[model samples]
Target: MNGVAVGVFVFFFLLVTIMGFAAARWRRAKALDNLDEWGLGGRGFGTFIAWFLIGGDLYTAYTFIAVPATLYAGSAVGFFAVPYTIVVYPIIFLFLPRLWSVSHRHGYVTPADFVEGRYDSRPLALAVALTGLLATMPYIALQLVGIEVVLQVMGLQAGEDASWFVQHLPLFVAFAVLAAYTYSSGLRAPALIAFVKDILIYVVIIVAVLYLPSKLGGWDSIFTTANDSFNAFNKENADAIAAGDAAPKAMIPPAAAHWAYASLALGSALALFMYPHSVTGVLSTRSRQVIRRNAALLPAYSFLLGLLALLGFVAIAAGIKVENAQQSVPQLFEQEFPPWFAGVAFAAIAIGALVPAAIMSIAAANLWTRNIYRAFINRDATPQQEARQSKLMSLLVKFGALAFVLGLPKQFAINLQLLGGVWILQTLPAIVVGLYTRWFHRWALFAGWAVGMTYGTWTAYGVPLPGDPDSHFGGPLELFPGAETTKVYIGFTAFLLNLLVTVVLSVVLRALKVPEGVDRTRPDDYTADLGDEGVEAEIDPHEPAHA
Candidate 1:
């Protein structure tokens, strides 16, 4: 909490912003028009840039703060995020190249655009687009949460006696800068800034992990301290469950908890690419081989993530305390790191927020421009118009994320993010399954999305929180009694519901002689590579007359 450290962080934060805006000229694309150029970094990122950009976009500011916070909050389950990152790259290795192939082949910018072209169903594409937009908003908000925790730790926010608006001004300024640069520079800003962001993050985490152990005695002492605290906390939880004092059931046994960890890890690994921002990163690459090479290399970041999650244990051992579980990582750094290093750590956290927030805004805006604005609102829109509209929508999207950050309880960001996963998962049948085959009816996919959204929302609302005033309307559902099998991921659960409805409805719809949408894609299309598709020509239908 050194003011000098805070000043240093502020300096680096501004430095990144200057670099972000300057990226528009760095690669120096001939022109920055259309989704291809503005929204996808000219779709020409080389191996090195792609590695940092995708890593910065995916690992995110939230990862800087929240993952360790969970570890600090008394659950081994939080460590699930690390293994999930490891598992995710291999899974992406299987499908993402295909996705990239199809996207490049068809000049598709968003996954919903792929669905629209594949099935010739505007409604289905719209459904996918809306789901992406919904899922991404809270995610963008969580970036603000990352920055907020850093500011809180720095003692930059107004004291407890200050007005709410006064206390949160830094949060609002952070949002404003993110929105402005993203709108002006699109994906280019974050792509350039990712270099600085990743370097700072690695430095901060490596320094903190190495330096913090001595202050907390040793690794053995740290783990023993953390284990003792967690054990005591669990004992109280056990007593509450035995007394029927807590809602749902007890936390899973350590063994069963491992399954929950593996499942969550695997599920998240599968779902990560389905997110529009991650897809934007995937699609921005110059070739499928570039993506493949990066996939192998990207796991290197997971090693960093593993260490990042361990910081939670570090926090607990250091005896750092915060009212919010999300503050654990920041609090740990504030306690152990020097003022200057703390500033660098805070910059890592702040710049981390900017990278993903920029990409998420771009992804969401691309969806709006391609799927909604062009598909339904203006079919004849030009690439220039598409870029203009996306820029405007990017602003609105960031503002909406800011509103979510300011308007709701802190826990709402977490819940909404989980809810977002549920929403995005509904698109699996339309986006992922449609990649290989179109056996599933397009109409059936729409029905499935509808049912999944309903079930996921209802399930989320029915569960209650621990030690909260409102008992019945807080958290996700517990699936089995006497077991700690709560459904934190309503998306996976709802996807099953969606799949069931889709299968049953497909049968019913086909039996009723429903007119299925035209299928314009072939299996070969999914395997198409760069230089084969003429994506630039397809995206810009009207080439210049002089040319």
Candidate 2:
């Protein structure tokens, strides 16, 4: 390991920490006394800060490492990330502004708060809040995974027969710093640090894409090498099949792993908007126009993602082999770049983790305070008390994410994130439908959520592992064999099930003359533009700016 590269990473991390603390004063709120200022960056982030903040939040350390790793592992299907991100803008443009207006009007901090106010059902709000908190935990842990992998790649943990504790010291120190500043400054810490993280990430990805290919004999050579390796594996499998024997193990070569690649990409795209942190990013913006403008502009990051995905191909060309596919990108950079540059690349990955991890914790905390603690635990909780409870809860959430990384096996956390997508999508019927019209009955919506949750989990669990006797999420949903097939995404299927149940229940309840809850909003409220009297131009002092 080059000491110089390690020094660069340490130096950059410290710089980000200082920035995090300084953000507490950056916007100079009238008062940083409550969740409004602390949790949502005072919700006053203009176009530039919001751009960087959301970009950093959505495209995280895991994206940096895992996207390329999937590519290197021979699953081009992971490129679904690009298309899903592209798809998300239209969806956001449709609903987010309305959410912002209603949330702004009602002092709603969490999406669950919106559910409570709109549906006037404490149970629905609690359900949404609980879902947000559960879904966020593994995502934060994946960030820690990103940082830990970087430290491991740097050989910081490579001492001769070193204990696991000794190897993970740097990772512990890194998160401890994160926990401290986040507890002190809240969402401002991550928003401030995101600037550095995005810049470094862009530089590393661009440089790697250009430099690695030249050393590895260009793009054509890389593809050819991967194809050749893939064909050899396929031929061996075909021969085994021809001999009336079982097919060879699927090594996740580029050709054979296409289904995994496509499914992961598509599933992740749908799941991205569902993450609470992404919602926090959107809600923090100042206007509907800001969200629309950013939606169109954010595809620039997709271009960056495409370039980042090619690093996996670069690893294949370099013939870099490791037990974990995710480590290939960093290892490829380490092999090709000088010590200092490699350190910069590693720092880019590690810092990328911190931006999303911080925002996720804050979002989870808001859900707990607004929907759970306020609704169920203590209806009389004041804003100051709520903020204090949220701050404490945010710390606890971070520790929970840390436990996911340190306590559980890596695959378990990854799988949990996949399950998280299934869980969060259940909220879409309530959140998205409630944005436009409250025609759907609250009870029907709740019933739909229950059906979707059960069906999605059962389907995912029913999938069997490759060659295993059990049938539970071994792979994705396979509609037909050989000739007829669809292995796209299970969440999409679950969402359909949810919508189906909701619609059917709505009709049944309407015939029965069940009382539908009153909607706090009108038609004009959703399509309302900037400067409309219904929407507030400034963030509420009592609530968060992002809300």
Candidate 3:
């Protein structure tokens, strides 16, 4: 069972567990009863901590496993993730500082909170709150998938010969630790743990990309082997599909998939920062300037992501064999590197899941507590009650994610992420556009979200997985609606439809003189900093910077 690797993995896992729990004391809150302290790290993380938290959160276990796995399984199309991250940063760079400004000014914790403040509409805010939670469920499942892959590779997964309890125990143990630390420490646990996760990941990827190519001849040999392998694999899939023997899969995107690639990249880029988790990271920072600095600095991760994506080609050069492509990186390391170092790398990948998972669950819980629970269920819930509700909801959210991965097929986890991208993208017009201008009527924006979400979900549910009884929750790409031959990213298609409807409905609703909600934000609120006169007293005044 790879005892040395398991030992090393266990060491790092325990270390992070300790840090997670201790983080409750690290940034010891002014009071533990408030959402600002518990859910958002007192809204005071600076440039350095913010960088690590955002990096560790975005380039997660799923990215570590999926990007390389996609490259290993498919060709250039897998590479779209690199460009997607790149584009997303510039977009966030332009917009997130503004979001930070307004959120901090008004003490808004979630994007839905911002929408509620801007539109003064509880129903509209509720829609966003629900969408964030729905999208996040599958996203959290993807993190578990990351953890599960690492465990399986470490020989911890229960096999056919093992009892069900015996096999699933490792996952439960790891997740239980995650939930406990996250519940106790809230956002601080992930913020503190991100440092270790990012460092280990950078070391592992730098060492692998530089070392693996030489071990397998060189870059030329690696690409040649990868090209040859993918060509053969695609041919096999094509033959099997012709024989009605299998679902079609490919190593590289075909010429026709150009639309698929571009749309997926653009759509994902737009949808990424819209996740409540991403906003949670942004809001946790101290100021608009921190968000701007992060936007400029985050491309370094995109650089790492680009290098990490190349590891797929390395797997081909190494001729690693695996039933699941997600195992290619772990299995490759197992084959080529010493067990101890491989253990460190595997720990980096597996523990990487925890940081993002913690933040995402917390973010989702905040949405539930602030926008749903407190807003609707208990209008007079005190800060302590809100914090308690958020903490409890965080547990439920994490367990829901855990159940998703354990109870369902692995493909369900994968498809759920795809659908997540689409569902979250539907919030762009209502949230991102609202940051710039309040010209779009709130009702029209809500209508657009509903229409986009409905179409995206319906089409996604109808996509066949060839042999499976239920349709594939095939992520971003789908058959271009009403056009059979061409395929496109469903997120982009839905987003466009959403924009059109919003524009049309705005004109119609304006003509009808429909009542628009009052905006509570000021003109200067979009650029307010932590200590600015307009900024709310969210960050504690005397909190020492860990400088």
Cα lDDT listed for each candidate? 0.82, 0.79, 0.88
Q: Cα deviation in Å at residue 433, candidate 3? A: 0.6
lDDT of 3 by residue, 1-547 (tens): 7899989999999999999998988767556677888888988899999999999888889999999998887645678999999999889988899898998877789999999999888988999999999999999989999998989888988797998889889999988999999989999999999999999999999999989888999999998888877677658688776664454445566777778889889999999999999999989998788889999999999999999999988998998989899999999988899999999999999889999999999999999999999898999988889999999999999899988987999987898788988999999998999999998998999999999999999888877665554666745568776875467888899899999999999999999999997999998998777778867454553563210
State each candidate's clash count. 1, 15, 4
Off by over 4 Å in 3: 241-252, 466-470, 481-484, 536-538, 541-547
lDDT tens digits, residue span 231-277, model 2:
67658678654552433332242454556456555656656776788
- Worst 10-residue lDDT window for candidate 2 reads 244-253
Can you tell me which runs of candidate 1 are displaced by over 4 Å?
Answer: 236-238, 243-253, 256-259, 469-477, 481-488, 533-547
Better of 1 and 3 by lDDT: 3
TM-score against truth, every candidate:
0.93, 0.92, 0.96
Report the C-alpha lDDT of model 1 over 1-547, residue by residue, as the tens digit. Answer: 5778978998998898788778777666656677888899777787899999999999998987877877777655677787789888887887888988888877789999899888889989999999999999999999988888889888889998999899999988888888878877778899999999999999888887788887778789988888888777667688675554553222222654555566566667767888999999989888888889998999999999988988988888888877888888877777777788888888998999999999999999999999999998899999989999999999999989888888988887887786677678778888888887787888999999999888877877776666654654354334533565433344567778899999999999889988887877777777777667443322231332111
Q: Provide the global lDDT of candidate 1 against the true structure.
A: 0.82
